[model samples]
Target: MAKSLQARKSELSDQEMQLKILSGGAFETGELPTFKAQLSKHKIQTLRPKTFSILQLNIGYMCNQVCSHCHVDAGPDRKEMMTRKTMEECLNVMKEFTIETVDLTGGAPEMHPDFEWFVEQIRLTGVSEIIVRSNLTIILANKKYHQLPGFFAKHSVHVISSLPFYKKNKTDSQRGKGVFDTSITAIKMLNKVGYGQANSNLKLDLVYNPSGAFLPSDQVALERDFKKALKTDFDIDFNQLFTITNLPISRFLDYLIASENYEEYMQSLVDAFNPTAAEDVMCTNTLSVSWEGKIFDCDFNQMLGLKSAVKNPHISQLNQNELMQRELQLSQHCYGCTAGAGSSCQGSIA
Candidate 1:
C-alpha cells in the first residue's frame, strides 16, 4: 500500500528525492530528450523573463484540506508560514517595482494570520490587480471565514477558486467528500456579494485541473460546459474557467509514481510539446515568491525548491534588470507547462 510523500515524510521529505526522480530514470537514460535539448531543437537558446508584471506569493503552507492533486502538498499539519517581516520585505519590493498584479497563493493563503493585512498593504501599493487563489471550500470551512465573500468584494480582489469539475462526485473525488457542495455554497455567497455576477466588476474565476494523470481538455470548451452546467443545476455564476495541467511535482508526482503512471504521463507531455506554448510559458513573465520570500521563475519551481538563477535570489534583494536577464531553471516537470495548449496560473497561454 502506497502513501503520500508527506505521510512518509521521514523517508522522503527530502526535496532531492523528487528532483532525482525527475532528472533520472527515462530522462537520464535518453528515453526522453531533456527540456534544455528540446528548447535547443526549437532555437530557443534560453527561457528568460520577458516582463515583471505579476508577483505571485505563496504566503503559507497550512490548509484545511489536503487535495490529492495539490502540487503544494498543503495541509493542516504543515506549519511553514511567512513571517510579517518577510512580508514587509515583499511590500518593499512591490513599492520599489512597478508590479501590475499581485497573486496570493498557499496551502490556502487566507490561512495566514495576517492575510487581510497583507492584502491591505498591497492595496496601498496601488497594484492594479490583486488575485487571491482561494480553495473555495475554505470560504465555508470555519465560522471566521464565513464572511470571506464580503471581504473579497470589499477589496475588489479577483477571486480564482478551484473547482475540478462541475459534478459533485468528480470534484469530491479530487478534493474531499462534500467539497463540491461547500464550494457551490461558497460560490453562491460570492455571487450574492456581486462577484461573478453578470456585468459586475468583482471578478470571480474558477480553476479546473484534470482529476487524474492527464492534460486538461480545451479551456474554451471546458469553460462552456462548466458555465452551462453550473448555471442550469445550481444557478451558479462565475466569470470564466481556467483549465490547468497538473505538473508532475509534489503530491501529484507522488500519485503518478504510486499509481505507476509516471512514465506514461511524462511521455504524454513530451508528445504534446508545443514550441509556441513553450515560448509563452508563465515563467517568462511571472516571478514566484516562496513563503519565506525566496524567488523562483514560477510557483512550480518554488515548490521544487528551485530558486531563481540569479545572484541574491530573494524578494528583498530583487533586481528588475538582473531578473529580466536571468535564464529559467528547467526540468522534466516543465514539460507540463508546454504540453498541449500550455498551462499557467491564467490558464492556457498558447
Candidate 2:
C-alpha cells in the first residue's frame, strides 16, 4: 500500500514537499513556463496591490467533513485554530485600515469557540461588509449550530455557502455523503430568516466549485442553471453564485498527482491564460490573514506558506504602506487564478 502524505511528513515538511513539487518536476524541466515567465511575456513586470479593500481571515482548520478537494487539508482531527490574541490583532488591523470587507473562513469557522465573539467584534469595526464562507451543512451539524441562521440574520452577515453542484450525486462525490440534502435543509433555514429573498438586505450566496479537476464553466451560465434547478426542485433562492477555481495545493494537489491529472491541468491553465484576468487577480486588492496571524497575498498563497513580500509580515506588525507597496509572491499555482474567465473569491474576473 502507498504511504499517506502525512506519513511522509517526517521525511519532508508538508509545505516543503508541496513547494518542491511546484518548483521542480515539469516546471524545472521547462515543460511548463514559470508563472513569472508567463507574466513577463505579457509585459507585466510585477504584480502589486492596487488597493486593500478585502481582508480575508482564515480563523482555523478544524472542520466536520473531510472533503476530497479541500485545499486547506482541513478536517475534524486538525487542531490548529486562531487564538483570541490573533483575533484581537486582526481587529486592530480592521480599525487602522480602510478595509471595506472582512471575510471570515475556516475548516468550519463556526467551529471556533470564539467565532461569535470575533464576528461581533468585527461588526464593531464598522466594516461595510462581513462575509462568512460556510460549508452549508455546518448549520445543521449540531444542536448548538441550529440557530446559526437566526444569529447570522440578526447581525446582517453575508453568508456564502459552498454547494459544489445542484445534484446530490455530484455534490456528495466531492463533499461527502448526504451533504446535498443537508445543505438544502441549511439553505431553507437561512431562507426562513429572509436571506436570498428578492431585494432583501440579508444576502445569501452559493459558491460552486467544479467537482472534477477542471476549470469552472462561465459563471453567469452556471448561476442561471443553479437558480433554475434549485428553485424548481427545492424552492430555494440565493443572491448570486460564485464559481471558484481550485488551485493545486494540499488535498487537491494530492488528487491531481494520484489521478495523474497534474500535467494536463497545468497545461490547460497555461493554454487558457488571459492577460485581462491576470490584471484583475484578487491578490491585488485582498490580503489573506492565516490563523496564526501571518499575512499573505491570498488564501492560496497562505496555504502554500508564501508570506507577503512585505517587511512586516504578521498582523501585529502590519505596515499598511509597506504591504501596499510590496510585489505579490508568485508560483505555478498562480495559473489557476489567471486561466480562462479568471477565478477569485468573488468569482469570474474577466
lDDT of 1 by residue, 3-36 (tens): 3457667333557888898999888999998888
Worst 10 residues of 1 by lDDT: 1-10
**Where in model 2 is the C-alpha error above 4 Å?**
1-13
Q: lDDT per model, in order?
A: 0.91, 0.90
Clashing pairs in 2: none
Which pairs of residues clash in candidate 1, taking residues 3 or more apart in a chain or in different chains?
none
After superposing candidate 1 on the true structure, give the runs of residues whose Cα lies further than 4 Å from its correct spot. Answer: 1-4, 10-12
Over 1-350, each residue of candidate 2 has an lDDT whose tens digit, in order, gives 22223534532228878888888877899888899999999999899999999999999988888887888878776788999999999999999999999999988999999999999999999999999999989999999999999989988999999999999999999888899999999999999899999968999999999898899999999999999999999999999999988888888888888899988988888898999999999999999999999999999899889999988799999887898899999999999899999999998899
Report the C-alpha displacement of residue 346, candidate 1, in angstroms. 0.4
Q: Which candidate ranks first by TM-score, i.e. highest?
A: 1
